[model samples]
Target: MATGDEFPLPGSTYRGPAPHFARFRAEQPVVRVPATGGGHAWLVTRYDDVRAVLNDVRFSRAASYAPDAPRFPGLFQAPPGMIISLDPPDHTRLRTLVAQAFSVERIEGMRPRVAQLVDELLDRADSEAVTAPVDLLGRFTFPLALTVIAELLGVPSEDQERFSVWIRQFAAVDGPEDEAIAAREQLGEYMAGLVVGKTAEPGDDVLSALVRARIGEDRLDVGELIGLGYTLLGAGGDSTACQLASSVVTLLARERDTWVRLGEHPEEVPAAVEELLRWVNLPTNDTSGLPRITVEDVEIGGVTIPAGDAVFVSITSANRDEAVFGSPDELDFARGGEHLAFGHGIHQCLGAPLARIELVLALRELTRRFPAARLAVAEQELRWQPADMNHRLLELPIDLHGKGF
Candidate 1:
């Protein structure tokens, strides 16, 4: 087995996609690599092969969490039966129930609020602009994403900070395992109480709506409700924040022209947003996207993956596949094409609509207000966490005064 540990995989130290991903794509697109837990599994790096693993019904995400299932190192296993850990039927049911809150109408109605929130956040960042090099991740993007999800879920403002802290620990890949588990439990307990309270005095928020949402006379139970909350906040908040921050970082560092185009022609922001989503390498290069297991023998790129073998799909590499993308590394909004940043098939991200709205609005406003914004520190000096969950920067020190707002 070629462990590939000799390669520089993205984690804390390496900031971009590991060079090995491209090499693997060329030499061995689908090969067995060491699993994080303790065994060998297939690592699919090519674009088409990744889509196969993601869309094929034979590959089971739910089974990947089985007691005897295999997991890659440092990959956190979601509690069994969690919405993200389920396959059809159960996943279908939960997704349907949760869809009420994130419907197109509901998210579209949030545009004004989203814009308002962006303005408020930028106002704060501008005030701190007196102290050049504001930490965009800590001060803006992270909080903005968390706050949006919190408000959407009807979490009280007073509780959002504490709630976000618990979530950070729970979702963190590098944190202590016990603490992350405890944080998850605490969040579940807190959400349960909140649900009960909302049941008594329902408000105009997602949680309140969730408390009332049903599926053929089957309402969400406390456990399912808590699990839903975890899925929403975890998936919707942390990952989106990291993605938003990385988009900005990548644009400032490598796609300055694209960033300028958005600033000059805000009308193009929507189209530009999609390209940004496709371009930014989530978690790390060759995203350790959601892990799935093969239920039956499956072959991809001429490699046979045995049943029960963990198959890790690299979205980062897929987005850059040379066959699908011309000049794959370049960030060109004109290079419009579908990319699987949101995980391809049935389990595609539920919060994708809202995430797109946030990213588009964020980039639009940031560019309009500070057209001259650039990295305060050199590109190579920027720090990145080494994990496969979301490509996140430790800090984004940026000069917010591009041509003096």
Candidate 2:
């Protein structure tokens, strides 16, 4: 059995790629751990094991509602209609309703707009007289993602900045519990008000579409509606922003030859995005044990996980399992798309198409405009968040080509 000491402290910042995950993958793919009190939980690391747990009906998402569920108590409270926190048939029904607004076809149609937004952001950044030390996280990635999500949800552009603050506060790594709770309440209230407005006057956005969609009588509880709004705003904006910023940083940190190869061959951009997604697995760990519950005693790779115990699946470790990925730690664009970054099975990220579109357009535009752009600071000197949940650069200072396109 493992203990808290056996896992890298959950919130500790890993500066570069995590070496510990590789070590764990080698020694213990499915490890049992002591949870609060005398209880035990399993931590599954291998690709096959993780995928199995994700799809297994016995291991339910409704585990979050268990009376004695051990979770990061302050971070998330189980909310209904949140596809991430529910089990079937509620999960199935909620996902089906929301799925209409998040379809791949709908997301694909927005690619042209995404491209235009990318070009405009780069053009504006280039126009600034002092551009060398601009933080990509702030200037390009965050704003671009925020704009996209805001427009998709029909959120008033004027209200974006205000809501953005609530998001940051709610997700802050080092906030007091009271502060975090306050932020969540504020965000809920704001979203509730917005839903009321949408009800009165429908718009051609996701929120209005959801408000008008028919499921059952109680398809969307009031809390669920507000929670969905908050979830979309936070998840859509934050994840894409981190990915966009990290892609640039990772590309520059690699050998100049690789950057040149990608820049010259635009066809490689999709492959590059996949490689980036594989390499940059930075979602918050599921200490909640909400997704997996042992209905019957199960043995994974010879490790016994007792029935009724909690389990945490490590996607980061799964993505780097040597058996599944050759040269797992190394970035290889030629490698086929097999990474679990968007997860596997029914629980895969709903925003994946949008994320891909944003990434492809951002990378293609940035490289085409500044073929010679390189990192102005050493990797060790770059500032990263203390939270291990995200691999982000606080600042990405780069030297742009003097002659702009």
Candidate 3:
């Protein structure tokens, strides 16, 4: 394919994967292409193939960090405690320390509080929406996600805004690299202080739990502790904000009946969230999925990627692969299939349970409040952030007076 065009396979925020992936799935399921980070890398698109690359131990996430290793620019995850960058023993060791907090039971227990927060935010929006429409991205989705993560991590109320500000800057794909670096350092410094505080007097939060956590006699040192905290806070907050916002836009603009039906029957929300996860493809990777190097030759989608070559498996393309998913582009709530939205294998998102809870509860509650909601402005007025990494809608001016969008 001569490293066709550039990489990342261009995608749309509102629409799913660009037409490119479908063609890639049908034709060259595995082909070499130029990556965003300045190198030719293999792009793997079919369903089973993408799943294979994700699960196969031969595809090394850890080794891709070597200076000479070929990789696409993804999460600038080059820190001591970044679990996504680690493999096997190290990843397993760190993940165990904080695993309990996001257990399904723990997250489900947070439902009442999540519902309460949603309602409170809605109440404030209701009062404020006398004439003007509310920016749901700002007022509802972002706040709902930020507050849930902040409270779970025990970020004090006063410091949350600062934490949020730094997080937004750090997560912004559109921002200057230097600014993101500065914000990253700021977040680390703040989290370091928080870790110190947690050590002195622990609280009933994830950070404090980590403060007391130990693997036998070994404990996370200050740098690793800060790194883990940074990873969780950055990932848990902004990613959810972008995803939930994108999902809400999907419901309001595209799937009105599903929205109304869910509003009337909140119990169905849990099931629907799975389909939503499958349907809304965000981190369709602005660069690509933390490129993995093949430890040995890997036969994926019929292509034998030689050992030590960087490969990117497109989850977005896989989720919509017609072979695995019938009528892949159509958003069917009744669809029955496991989707790789949270990813697959050992590295699936640790926060999947919490993300599902937020999506389910937020949508369930939101529909009840604004069943008639539709776009406040014409569809053209809706703006999505430029393609950097994930699909993100910038501002959704939702008219809550009658219905909502």
Top candidate when judged by lDDT against the true structure: 1
TM-score of 2: 0.90
lDDT of 2 by residue, 1-405 (tens): 323443333432222234545656788878765554345557788889888878876776677567866554323343544677777787788778888777677788889989999988888877762545555677789989989988888888899897777777777655676876788888888888888888899898788878877765645656667877876876688878987787787787765566677778888889889888887656544332234777778777777777777777777778777898898878788888587877776677788889889998898888877788777677667887655345556677766663221
| Tens digits of lDDT, candidate 3, 1-405 | 333556655544545776677777888989887766687888788889877777788898898878878745544444534878788888788778767445667777888898899899988887877878888888988888888888887888888888878876777766888998999889888888888988899998777877787778877778777877776776677677777877777887788899889989888888788888888877745223477888898788778989989887778788888999999899898897998888888888888888887887788878888887777877767877764346667787888755543
What's the residue-level lDDT of 253 in candidate 1? 80
Backbone clashes, each candidate: 8, 0, 5
Deviation (Å) of 27 in candidate 1: 2.8
Shift in Å, residue 238, candidate 3? 1.6
Better of 2 and 3 by TM-score: 3
Cα-based lDDT for every prediction: 0.79, 0.72, 0.77
Q: What lDDT would candidate 2 get against the real structure?
A: 0.72
Off by over 4 Å in 1: 1-16, 386-388, 402-405
The number of residue pairs in model 1 that clash at the backbone is 8
* Root-mean-square deviation of candidate 2: 3.2
